[model samples]
Target: MSTSLPSAEPTPSPSRPALRKILHIAFWGVDAQTLARDIQAHALTQPGWTERLHITAHDLPHADCLEAMQTWLTSELQTSGTRPHLSLLVPSGAAQNANAGELQLRNALISAGVSFQVLYGATSEERIRNTTNAIALTAKAILPSSERACFVVSDIAKPINPRMRSWNCEKCSDPECEHRLFTGLLPA
Candidate 1:
């Protein structure tokens, strides 16, 4: 009998790493941060999630304090080239003066030109919809406008006031603008 030749396997080729989209979510409170960590841990342990989009996750851990979160948010806003997407996970009030924490969060975010809304739902679909919307909102997608109109300003110009010390504003908005011209708001 003739000896059969052993089959050869093709060598693997090097390829570029898979692109990953980082969704940086800033927790509004300690409880929220803890819950997020727990969720991440559980998801990683679950086989189903491991098979999904998430492979590995890493971020600078918040120092179990609100100051850390605020600082991180501020720093990211200052440096992130593209419009930074902020996902604020606000937890229910457990402490007696939880409102204080809420207020601090609001102050930090608002001062940085970030707007937010609280979402609560009774059903999974509702929750998902709310969450999708919240993310979209954070990304500055103009949706659910009271006037139900969409506007795009192809020509954007910087207006200068020669009279009053050359008024300078980081951003400008005009709700009355019928065209709904995008006035440097919600770039994300």
Candidate 2:
């Protein structure tokens, strides 16, 4: 009689798909300390968010913003242990094609195996409103159908005024209100 070999059991695959994590990182033209403080404040307000969500706030020097961003992103990917989606919030004006900085950033991210999207909006009220719309649309377009969230990296120094916040808001009745007149534009 010939000896028979023992049968091996098949390895089981994952039953459910993993939840998609989105990390929004904002790069403000502020000091690193201030950025860290702001991020901490946000984290404190939202309980358990820091653990579950991937929100990051950082400073980006105007001189070499793209290089800085690329380096930071690569570092984050290596350290975070999660392949969360990425979105960059840069001033609309700073995204000019003269230097091709945005293009370089995009290429770097792709080569590093990171999925990313770039959304631009002026700090001004009108432009910010448009940017919000763009952000939403882009999120819908780029995010996979599975569970996902958006992370925003921006240079928004202060909260936007209520009337000017929403894109559909009617013109402010009080013309004298400085907030109403303020466009929230950041320095180029």
Candidate 3:
């Protein structure tokens, strides 16, 4: 007698594929859109899924991003007449641990009662792409699909490109180096 191992996720039925709506808050602009699209496209190519990604709004601030977010939210409520329930899949590509900006964004959202979840990040080039895959993997662990959701790449996200680098991490010791801000490994 051969014992078969159980399948990880129930094999999605072809007849009834999962349908989901994704409103992308593209704080990272084209970068975020690319990541979101990659994630959604991969999901669609998988066994079962049908999704629509609508780039919802672009109001990220260079200085204070969450302030723009709050204003946008208020305006949206006023226009739509109903608060859109959001299951935000926020994928941030940052190497270091949460800093003040990141914390502030989370805190403001918490105060506003906006639902969200943040994804992990790493150093060097392709940080955004790696984070995208990581987000998809973790998300699959929770549920294969959802009824409604949002893909949010935080405005605080700094794209890492090591190709044209001038500053050396070893030579630089400034704790607040702009180079190290987004892609440096935090000290233990």
Best by lDDT: 2
Cα RMSD of all models vs. native, in order, equals: 18.0, 15.7, 12.9
| Candidate lDDT (C-alpha), each | 0.38, 0.42, 0.40
**Which parts of model 2 have CA positions greater than 4 angstroms off?**
1-52, 58-72, 89-92, 96-101, 124-188
TM-scores, all candidates, are 0.38, 0.36, 0.39
In terms of lDDT, the poorest run of 10 residues in model 1 is 1-10
Off by over 4 Å in 3: 1-31, 51-59, 63-67, 76-92, 95-101, 123-188
TM-score rank, highest first?
Answer: 3, 1, 2
User: Given candidate 1, what's the lDDT at residue 74?
Assistant: 70
Model 3 Cα lDDT, one tens digit per residue, 1-188? 01111112344479966444332222222134444444445444434223433223222223356676566445543554333233233333432432445555555557667655443334322544544444444344443355222232233244343322234666667655655565566663
Colliding pairs, model 1: 139-188
Q: Rank the candidates by lDDT, best first.
A: 2, 3, 1
Worst 10 residues of 3 by lDDT: 1-10
Residue-level lDDT of model 1, residues 149-182, one tens digit each, is 2112222233221111112233333234412344
Stretches of candidate 1 exceeding 4 Å from the true structure: 1-13, 41-73, 76-84, 92-96, 119-188
Tens digits of per-residue lDDT for model 2, 1-188: 01111112234459844332343443322332343343434544443324333444433323356566567667655554555443443322442332444455555566766655343334444344443443344446666644224324244344334332223325434554444455454443
